[model samples]
Target: MSTTRTRARIATILAGLLVAALFAAPTAAPAAADPTTRHRPSPPHVVGTATVPVYSYADAIRESVWVETPADSDGDGVRDRVAVDVVRPREAAAAGVRVPVIMDASPYYLCCGRGNESELKTYDAAGVIAKAPLFYDNYFVPRGYAFVAVDLAGTARSTGCEDVGGPAEVGSATAVVDWLNGRARAYTADGRRVSAAWSTGRVGMIGKSWDGSVANGVAATGVPGLATIVPISAISSWYDYMRYNGVRRAADYPGYLHSYVNGRGEQACADVLARLRADSAEETGDRNGFWAQRDYRPLAGRVRASVFVAHGVNDLNVTTNQFARWWQELAEQGVPRKLWLYQAGHEDPFDVRRGAWVDTLHRWFDYWLQGLRNGVMDEPRVDLETALGTWTTQRDWPAPGTRDVRVALGAGDGVTGTLGGRGAQPGRERAYVDESLSEDALVAEPGTGGSGRLVFLSGALTAPLRISGSPSVRLRIRVDRPTTELTARLVDYGTAERIRYDSSEGVRTLATESCWGASTAADDACYRDTEEITAVTDHAVLTRGWLDAAHHRSLRFTTPLRPDVWYTVTVPLNAYDAVVPAGHVLGLVLGQSDPDFTEIDDRDATVRVDLGRSELVLPVTGRAGLPSVAVAPSVVTAPAERSSARTAPDNRQVP
Candidate 1:
């Protein structure tokens, strides 16, 4: 099985097991409290220059508390109390210096450790942290920042149930920020009310994967104190995590994650898990209110905080489309943001880009949290890593002036069809059956006859073409069945061998150690050795797009096409960075089904392609100076919240 397929098969199990990983002081005057409510000034009154260190980690203060929230998700709860473990420079207490807060509220704290060390939080009898995960505190505490590791709302020494990415999850994190900023209240485990002293109330949330997803969700709430967020490889929608388009993925994955995150054995969260499975709409594989509540993009316009988004282009664990769509939403909101795109798979930039990641992150924090005069904002907005392991910077992503270049598919010698920019000549329609097939099986040799798929090829290119963004497939076709799944892959066909991402998920780690930042005995900013992902092979599948013929008109509504009718649907391929060398050819594969996912009904359907009407649209990089046309939406859709789904003309993103 392919590495991606394997991960999808055991997504919840691996996500639960691999969840490890990864917070500050106040400097400026606190934001005003409501005149109706009483308020007290924050602790540590003095402040220092942003460029210099103001506190000492060796003599830092450690403490823990329970923050009270308004909701009670767990049945046995009396409202929710979030556990917060804090570490900050002793200088703040000794000399009355103030610092900003950096927090990482995570559910992984109790079940899986964080970082390469898999370090879980440890506390002394006084309920103070004896050990915290990663080096966020070790490196930043001395620099006058308070780092707090929160155990989310549940799972670790806190009250309430873990609702995955539901309302409770988002509310819990925002409540903590509220308390720090003097808007909400917290208490000691002994039932004593506590307040967040030693804080400027300026908070910046950062984390990877699940931990980061929480940050994104919290910021979407438009929380006041959250000044900025850095979410690495985070999921924008939980639905996208478990399902793709309108197809149900590997079975039992969502149930497994919910139960595992509860960490109180199967019986403890069986009801919650059961409820999740029931509400998922897995039977119809359609988008519902359950998934809509967890999606953050809709809340993007309300976000008041700056965002620094980062994700691996090769990440299959949390597919790239989720990030692409979310990032675009943030851009449309006109939020102050920066982006870091890497070439590696499901790994953190702290490990992938190391030196640069740290330096940039430090400046980012200093500028936002400390109100520093640093020129961080003046720098380029996009820091992207290409497939070759090299780096490039641009003013913005989608690289400013990209042009959508269309390549039409024409009739060819029976098996492989011709694909190019030249207008396609009218030709006989090609047909294919819907059958679950592996990527390799569908993309055999050029002349290889296949009953399950159709392969179309573009002549060897005389000049290299760099594609910076997603490519949409516009196809006009007729299918016999009411609903049939369509899978399209934009591939680079070359004689030279390439890395098989299916083998090791694109990258592997070595035994040697590569230190990223400063370190101590219990905590180190360094990590195990690593190399860029590679494996010389023949052809490389660049990107893929999927659609359900019946639901092509709308992801929420099932509108199957009439047997003899010809309809047009534009499918947006998953986002990726690919450069076709001068001598390599580009191939497009039209397959009925991908074995990687379980779409259930495997009914065979014959599809007839309208050669003259359909075309492959490529976002050719460095064509900004060229005349650019307005790009179409990923798919046609309707306002999805209502009972009957209709075409939502503005809804464009579809995969």
Candidate 2:
């Protein structure tokens, strides 16, 4: 049989087995023999053989089953199937119980299907989990909630392989919820009261990376049943993911495409990848067209579910700017949202920090689905200030009192005063040699030397410097070449070690007015000067400008383009600090290119600093002797009433 036919046969067999089991299991109570009474709703038949005896809510629920639903919900041309796992309550307690439901859409294809059954079950049974190394199912099922893992429509045992975003995927998710409700009723032995369990109807969603993206998409449907969502490592802008800033992200694109197409033995994904690969750079550049169609930002307002967006501070694959855009857009629409920034990487999902994340999810569901009198709703909406690893709550993201600090770059050797400048002065420029590396270095990995880079350090801070908000840099530079690339990185220096804080890089393509058309030439002149012209090279360039480190010149005046043109580039530093302790030092590292990041190569790339024209700007927050503040200890409120004490209210502040 063909793959589709084989899958269909398996689904049919599973459904038949479930029906048989339902018929075989003795009913707890019998209804009247009257046809009318028989016509009334009977306990849902438990179709599949019970691999594990049904237990109480306390023991832990773990059962894998395939849910059958009409492939075509609306008699549409297309059809699909949704596979789900129903994790029952652990202990054998009362029947009529309302438990929270967590619907996790798996990112890895194997984890949700038979291919990964053994591994998933091991984790499910063993209760050990990590994001990068292991599948997510192991971590979720043991958490005392019904975890529904959906195989989506086209992967593993499901039908239809068109993974494109639309009704198909959404319908699959909806169908899984319906199936879970039925299974929950069946597991409750058809008790009328038990069938009315809280989770049988209420459900929430949470996932990381691809799973997270799906959660965001499903939430956008405004599905009434979906109570809340926690999307981590999810990019809001599809355009940004496929094309960075604006340029096609050559390095990551092929790998991602390959994973979706061939990773799961799903044939349909091959076509989608083909189309994506066939699209030309120009075709992909039109953001308002098909690219926008794939983006989630346009659908942000459509998402009615409360959301907790988590992103890493140093996610090179998906920059922090993307998260900033997501937060800003959601806020602009007045969506109930929370933002969590961590000092980690893309694969941080499976990290131990996930325990805290899972706890947060549980509290959110308890508040929304259980209608508990938990203070989850009243807790600060934002958590985690990057510099400070500790959890800090806030009313909103980019909270009040966020200050911007400017750090200057100047020509300098190891630790010399020769290139000293007191905040913005023009001087004779000196160039530093550019070095290139054979291979790209991992951004998070320390101490792999590469080419065209400069490092500058600030004197040890006298007092604890807590910098929050974005970091921007202004630099004076001249390049021997017509066009150059520049990269800047902010580093927090420890006495024994130096760690990367945040970085941004970009490239500058020189403009030759002769190459432009009459209309284009006019526009170019309007933006660019003869000595230093700024032309509308391309939006892609601007998008790449988000991280390009092509050129930097003194900000003093319009320096003429000579043998080496000196121009100043002002770069924004988005990442900031809550507090850099007094003992630590602040450092800035500049490079022509970040090998571990983008492959922007510039030979003979030399950055000259007129020390007389440089200064390092730091944003300092005024401190009050560590004020005493009361924080809620738990995510949810306790059952018993505690002493009524109110803490001094600090008007939700952010700069």
Candidate 3:
């Protein structure tokens, strides 16, 4: 036997034996004297903390249905119908046993696909689903769970206009939960009405990226029958996806993404697409009704389902701020939640920690969906990656002893400044011309005055410095132009090997495959293994923030700056966690028009900063001032930085 097949067989046997040894209870009673017992099918097997595989995966029933929704985004005068595919154990119907659901709703099923292999859904000759993408169906169907795949409205086989993350898109997915609970109607491919007779109506939604975002929106609605949600690298707000603060990072993003996901029925959706472009208002980049409809944070108080969130600290596509704000809101509402923080970028936990991830997820589903008395909730609430391949368990995020440390930016050579100093020179000021340049060119020299960025350096740390939350920057400044994009970066200067997040999302697929459950010819349960990618670098950008000067006061309103007049603006950087080495130097860079993250504009603008009034507030462990020191004036050299793409972080083509 080949090594791959042998490993696959071993893994399957181990997972089965794990639960069987723990409980070892008969699932069904022996056939009785009653004649009716002979015709009844066996029930699902149950163990101590999970359901063991007792049904045949190949014989599971596979079919498709169209669910009626209230949204008529396409303006066809008829209500929109969402496409839903289902795979469940045959025993669910024959033995009169109703099973729970595991659902993944996404627009990527047709255009971009799902998982590391990018597998698309395939159909059989009967026009029914043959091969469903990913291993969800193959693994969970035999364990007494129904797996559901939904083609979001306006994408794939569903009908309607893709409104990005607005009401239309959210309505399409939530309608499925309503259908399972007997609150909505559904029909077969032949237009015959159908009902979820074999379902328990307990749903758990899980996915990555946009698929995960849909789960967030649906959970915010507090729909009945939604047991829990597992959102990996998901976005909490649509405004944060297209821009940061008031700076527009991508122009006409809604229209561009809509075109990417919906390649068919263009004419029918022309009006909807046009409205998406106008409502986004790329020119102003201010928050309005369109954005409010898509924001999920305000509705956190209404969420009834437990949440399990997983995010990559270095993920620049959806970014860390999304999960940060979502986690905070869930906590404030006193909701049950769990979190997993990794060191990669834009990837799933199944790809990073395959074995542990599967085990934990299995227990979580058993507890929430099956009502098992498992100890999954008795463990720690947070799992954070401290370094490459190393993890630690914590009671909560932001480490318990973290405090905000205020560091002064002192004028040092009229160009570069000193951080963590005793006091600042109030009368001293630094000036820089706003121009388009790579981050490497802007942060090149620490002691020189020839660059277009104002740099500040702290002395070499004698002890390790660990930051665990979002960092904020307060700048008192005046600009030569009425409006310009303002940017700030927190950097680490040292020579070390770190996860290569910018390269293939820090993972490489291998030839060897690992199987999770039973399989068949059309849909299998095995997938290619993956390994983390690392690189040796001199420096790394810890976090960055951007803002439009005109909208500094509020994300909803804009007031152009008065040339030569000082304005105090606060820029909040992305949330992150890192431990700087004892000998590494912490640096801060302030500039305009970051070519790597923001749109380039107003090249002739110039910015001036009052060194005394500006400060950086960081959430650090131990004494706030213990990890910072003033750098010697003679040490002028700094390390070069790396840049990432300024477009969407997916593999699909964009306009």
Query: Model 1, which residues run further than 4 Å from truth?
Result: 1-54, 125-127, 265-268, 423-427, 495-505, 514-521, 597-601, 623-655
RMSD of each: 13.2, 21.0, 9.8
As for lDDT, the candidate ahead, 2 or 3, is 3
What's the candidate order when arranged by decreasing TM-score?
A: 3, 1, 2
Q: lDDT tens string, model 1, 1-655? A: 9999887778655433322100111122212222211233333322332444445555678888888888887655588888998888887766666678999988888678876456788777777787788778877887778898888766788777777788888898899999888888887768788888778778999998888889999989887778889988888998877766776655655666666567455565566677788887877777888889889989997777788989877776777877888889988888778999887666678767677888898888887786654677889999987655678888987877777888777666666677764434554577888766766666656455667787777766677778877888898888898878788988777755444456444556778876543455555556676566676656777888777777787777688778879889777788887567876777788886665543444667888888778888888876421111122111111211211111112211111
As for TM-score, the candidate ahead, 1 or 2, is 1
lDDT of 3 by residue, 368-472 (tens): 777665788789999998889999998887787988888888776555677787637775688887756577767666666654688888877788899999998
lDDT of model 1, residue 227: 81
Worst 10 residues of 1 by lDDT: 20-29
Candidate 3 lDDT at 561 equals: 90
Model 2, global lDDT: 0.45
Better of 2 and 3 by TM-score: 3
Per-candidate TM-scores read 0.85, 0.60, 0.90
